[model samples]
Target chain A: MPVKLYIDAVREALWEEMERDSRVLILGEDVGVRGGVFRVTAGLFERFGEARVIDTPLAESAIVGVAVGASAAGLIPVAEIQFADFILPAVNQIISEAAKLRYRSNNDWHCPLVVRAPYGGGVHGALYHSQCLEALFTHVPGLKVVAPATPHDAKGMLKAAIRDPDPVLFFEHKKLYRSVRGEVPEGDYTVPLGQAQTVREGEDVTVITYGMGVHWALAAADQVAAEGIRVHILDLRSLRPLDEQAVVAAARRTGKVLIVHEDHKFCGFGAELAALICEQALFDLDAPIQRLAGPEVPAMPFCPPLERAYLLNADRVAEAMRRLARF
Target chain B: MMEQARHRRPEAQWRGSGGEVHEFHEVHPGEPPRHRALGLDDAQAVEMYRYMLLARLLDERMWLLNRAGKIPFVVSCQGQEAAQAGAGLALDRQHDYLLPYYRDLCLVLLWGHTPRDELLAAFAKAADPNSGGRQMPCHFSDRKLRIFSGSSPVGTQIPHAVGFALAAKMRGEASVSFVSFGEGTSNQGDFHEALNFAGVHKLPVVFFCENNKYAISVPEHKQLACANVADRAAGYGFEGVTVDGTDALAVYQVVKRAVDKARHGGGPTLVEAKVYRLVPHSSDDDDRSYRPREEVEEARRGDPLVRMRAYLTEVGLWDEAAEVDLRQRIASELDEATAFAEQAPYPPEESLYWYVYGEEETSHAG
Candidate 1:
């Protein structure tokens, strides 16, 4: 085991997979000599050379399009969008081209491609940079959306995404890139897609969240535990093709649930989670499903103080947890 | 009989005179340019003419079926048949990958789709292997023939074709990917991106733009400001050639050279075939709203089929008897295809929800 930053965990997974399979290649803007805007692909370009670690043009549609094509031609490509907000230009390629390649061809062809983008707020990123778009892709069929909440999950899920025989949208929380540190396994490993990680156990209430929400919920759970209220935290690592069984079981375990997410409160991912819980385990629950997410503003502001206020954190999660426990 | 003939319009009335056919060189119809010579024998030349003719015939039949409510839609290759026949025949179908646009009826046929395959797709029958009756007609695709499934979204296939070429280059294979699109598609961001990627990587690909002068009633001048679609290829760091698409031999010669260059790792080349939209864009479109009647008449006079037929007759590979035999053969094949596709069963009810995700058994060990 080795302690690694979350971004480093992703980089290590990319490095390990490229070493393991020559067919797995990397492509995106500034991914080669510049080592990516966030340096997630640092040094892999020199190690693998240009063919495997390609520096592509400033065209998101083409990057995804080429990935779809190359995947069909027997190459597993991991394409990156510098920021998740910039992925709108490529939604056509992502939704129409890559996702439907397998289905439209009637099993004749498929796109085993991974699109990695750093998403979320809390770093003073303004309207352009700090936005969560997972819910948009989550609605699409034939596409798998994953948001890893830990270094271990980051390394494991990315490797799994590359190996899966479909297109995957891996949304890496930018705030947790360097802030989160944990022990990551040394050798080849994978956390299967469409699975959930129940990070903490409790008897009173279950805090369901993902990405940065996982960390915030854990801290909220700890503070609440000291006050005599035991809280359970479930990290939904994969959003699309969600772990419904785990979600229902978690809802059944606590009988009271609070869904926390940094995404917008209106029609956010929490909406879907809430719907699933209500649909699956409504009888098991003693209370109505509670959702604590960002206010329905357009996006996060740039000022550090305001950005923190706009984003969800442990303090907000604690308030929500106390309310749920009291209820 | 003479009284019936007298009552007919002067243009329609039969005249007693010596009707003589002229040499191809003598008939300078519709300003056909000097055709570049190809390494094709007389028989091969006849085959080229036949491909263009068959494409036209199939296109006509599709429109008939569509109008009769037997088929849903048709994206015709009527006026661009020369470009389709010549460029498609130029590729090495045995090894090359083809990414044909929706209007490429003849090009897909060169890649080995039978008349029945087209009809079955038009009928959206259960036996239609292109998409298992899922996709619409004219969206040609078949893995067995190396034809990647085409999309209704124009210019999307350009990148996929480039990907195929990249795969060939990495595998150390001599295979080339040939992709086609309408001139209007050149304005798409995907077009620029695909060519840019191919140029940067020096992929073994050839981009063919079937410049049919109109994209469903939007004229080319309004779509692109450049002098020609081929002119835009220079931005992608490749050679560009604008050939007279009416001359099947010239189109064949130009595309043949491009295929050879791509196979030799010379990077991609853009070929713009300046053809006319012989009919409305599709069975659903009405060109009279935008395209002038005089312009349509001019294009009909320079029809690729008429030009190619003249070339075949001049080369002495065709005659009235041969023409009659060829028509009869083509008509019989189409008749058989029509009967088969018409009677083909609809897909099973459960199949409507199939293929949205793969059926591969996932490994639970991960």
Candidate 2:
């Protein structure tokens, strides 16, 4: 096994997949010569040439819309939105066109498009650059949403997304791109979509989270272990078509569940997780479901104090876990 | 009655130095016929006229069905039949892809959609090949015929057409993607974005704007800040042409040239077909609310079907017997389609849950 950064894992997936299948192409702003704004797609343009690594105009709508059309025409298109906040202009293309193509055509036409965007806050990227929009796409029925927390998951899930017969939204946490590192398998492998994995097992409380929140929960679990309060952690790799069985099983194991995410606490992905937990394992719960998420502000502010106060960390997760354990 | 009205109106004339307006009859006293000059033989010209006539009859029948409370909606292609039929016939239907808007009955028919298929979709029957009763009427799609599925969101199909062209270029195929929309749709951001992308990439796609003057009550002057939709193509670095949509031969010549240029790697073209909507926007709309009734009656005088028929008759390829026989044949086909669609069953209740995702693993596994 070789250790790799989360961003490198994603790059490797693109490099390997494009090498394996000539139909796999990348299109977005600065993806050709510049190798993407964050260097996530670095060196791909040089290797695959201009035809596969397309550099599009500054329009987000065209980037996604063209991908939708190309996917239907038997080419695997992986479109990139420069930032998650800027993806609003392409909501119509993503939600209305790509999401409904197969269903509207009655399976006569399908869009195998993968739209990747750098999301989440932490590196002083306030407001516009730092936002989690996975919840918005998760609400769309025909689209599959995924957020990978580790290098292993990022590489495998991206390969799966590119291979999917339908449209997929792959949200990469910008903060974890270079910060997270783990051992990734050398050869081709895939982490199936719509499945959840239990990272840490315990007998006290279960912390369900994804993306950046997953790392925070794991740290909190380790910190709380000193106090004899064992914590269970479940990383939900797939948001849409949620792993209901794993969610319920995690809830039933410890009888105390705490949901965590960086999105708004109101109507966030955590709310859906809470609803699913209560619906399936309501009687198994020893205490009420606890949710730890960002405050309901419009977005993350610029200043360090305000930004720190807005985002969740290991201390915040530990405090929430302590409160739930006391209950 | 129509012949008497035709004799009443003055001879249609071409004006403007820019060629924005075209003469109704392209055959001058001494020169060759316009269709012959455009490389269309006698049979091809007659077939174009027949397609325009079939579209008119089919559209008129849809209106009757709507008025009789038999169908839910009617989006007429009354005044733009020449633009549809002529441009459609010019494409290499065997290899090209069509992304048509709602008012493209004639174009889809030229691409292999039969009168019965249109009727089945209009009735929202189970056998409807477009959407299996899921979409509204005129939202065309047929995988076998290479007609890309379109939605009601006006200009969204523009980029999709560009994508098809992009794929064709990538695969080293000489396929052109043809897309059509109304004049108002040119204002959409997707339209500009799609055109710019296609221009930069030199993709093989054609952006056809059937400028029917009004986009559901908003007149052309109110919709555009420039003189013509075709003029906007210059900003994207491409050739743009404006032609009279009522003259089938003129439209055929322009579209054929554009398609040929695209297939040879010359990039995209913006073609604006100046025409009119001969009816209200849809069955639910009432033209009396905004425009005067006389304006619509005036537009009916330049109907593409009527103009194409007159051209065919002048060229000695059509006569009273030919007209009567064509109408009789279309009437029987329309009658049979109506009866079959009216009795066709709606999609099954459980079908609503199907096709949301593919059932099998269509992924390219390593």
Candidate 3:
């Protein structure tokens, strides 16, 4: 299979999942008729029918809540929140009820559902349309949060998420959806959740990142490789049950690390990784872990300079990579 | 006939209508229904007493844990034990389901959750059975007991219960799903949406609101313009009934009827269990900041545990000595739970990656 884009992978995954399981369904605004804002769910309604690919009201709460209800009833509902920023309205359903149902009941019943949203900045999406809120979801227990950077991972992880018997928040980086593509197997396959993918291997310094940050980090690593600094890049596919072991092992190998994330630096998922590495794998490090995050800026801006400054692009990652290599 | 002609279509059927329909269920004019009966025997009564007492003790201990810096937070259901215990006993664990809010510690335990799990969840210990120490205390989940986990947000579970009930109907199963939330949750738009959908679809559900008269600092007066939570049911086109939540027997009888009605395809019912939150909203909250000490003292007068003790005494089912013994036993058990959780290992650094999705080995091994 030739390399495919993330959005195409998502489309193919949904198409394949619906084809494989009659119980799987899609519900969200413009998802059915308008083919979703990003067209990730384009043509789904035509193929799966309206009942399967439902065009829900503009209520995000209802979309998520109804999905919770539908999932509790034994349907595998993949609900799209359109923009990740719009997900706050439905946060209660995802954070409180959908996440805790099985734990509170002591494993009596399980909420087997997936909530999909287009997250992150780039493409000039304003504040509301762009945000890497994986930390918010990861901070919550009883919920599984996954963000894939490649088409193959998207297809594999999404299929696995749909089949899993718990609620999962699947974040598709809006910037990478159409831009990032790779070969995804046509047959049944699943990228295990809570695992990290080593996108590039090196030994001088490790770059730990996820979602869109993976691409930026990879780009930085490639640039740094020209200077003879080997950078080990670990793309965190999942945020909640973060692959700490992979991070620890990589940290141990390089003895230096740079945490890069599109989310603001303060209280970001990168902070969690920093804490874990310090708490358990501190002895293996040669220097303090450096993090080059999007400037602790407010958010995505309408202006090009402001947006560029707010997003953690390849340049920042490259600078951080060089700094860590020196360390 | 003239009155019927003059009256407009009930507002419960649609949004923006003030007729009191909750979420999706409606309350049409009719005789109020009850829950399925729990055939109480001496042994079962004793079990209920133990469960209620243990729940109360656990709530108090958790509150202390929060104060002592052992647990991060606590949401105690002190005065609402009878309602939770009796309603829990009324349901068929195998066929029915419960979607509880954060305050439903007893209901969670009664439905088969262990105290060890609750303690771990409360302490945010890595060994926490609910989410591997991911969620904060009181946020619980399990897949085996047919009980839905709860989030911190109120009123979100209402529609989930409706969906579960709808599934039961679709599956041709004689099952009902009961969702429990506090009185303040009725103010939410989702609450109305869930009730309306339940009533319109005739889904087998019991929407029970533990009317404790407060949403953190806001009292029932500010929470709703309606006279009572049950009164809002009139808008939903189904029978809404208000029961004394402190009275276990009364709550049991009413809930039993509602469950029975649901099981027999009578659709959903809105049952409001009027009660009170004896403790502060949570360990992190201080009731004195907003609630008058006098009001807290007054609310404490009708504690459900005391009422149950009186009821059991009148029926020659309990006495002072029996109460002391039971209290001592429950206290000891809760103490053990706290000690066990404190000593349990924090989630291993590597263990963080476990169980996000069910491990194929575990899912298939079992």
- Candidate 2 wrongly placed segments (more than 4 Å): B1-11, B14-25, B360-366
What Cα-based lDDT does every candidate model obtain? Answer: 0.85, 0.90, 0.79
Residues B1-366 of candidate 1 have per-residue lDDT tens digits of 001111111311111121123424522446333232356666667778787777788889999999999998888888888898889878899999998888888888877998899899999997776876778888888888988887787899998898788778877899999999999899999999999999988999999999999988899889998889888888888888888787787788888889999999899999988888888988788989998998987677667776677656665567889888988899999999999999999887966566666544242111
Which stretch of 10 consecutive residues in model 2 chain B shows the poorest summed lDDT? B1-10
Flag regions of model 3 displaced more than 4 Å: A49-75, A92-109, A202-205, A221-231, A252-256, A275-288, A322-327, B1-94, B100-156, B169-174, B188-193, B196-203, B210-219, B230-366
Q: List the residue pairs that clash in candidate 2.
A: none
Cα error, residue A13 of model 3, in Å, equals 2.0
On residues B27-111, what C-alpha lDDT tens digit does candidate 3 reach at each position?
Answer: 2346221111235766666667688888888888888887787777777878888888878877887778878887778888888
Order by DockQ, highest first = 2, 1, 3
Error of 1 at B283 (Å): 1.9
lDDT assessment of candidate 3: 0.79
Q: For model 1, which pairs clash?
A: none
lDDT of 2 by residue, B1-366 (tens): 001111122434432222222334555788777788788899989989888899899999999999999999989898999999889889999999999999999999999999999999999998889997889999999999999999888799999999999999999999999999999999999999999999999999999999999989899999999989999899898988888788787788888988999999999999988889988999999889889988887777666676777677777788889999999999999999999999999987967777777644244111
The TM-score values for the models, in the order shown, are: 0.94, 0.96, 0.67
Best by DockQ: 2
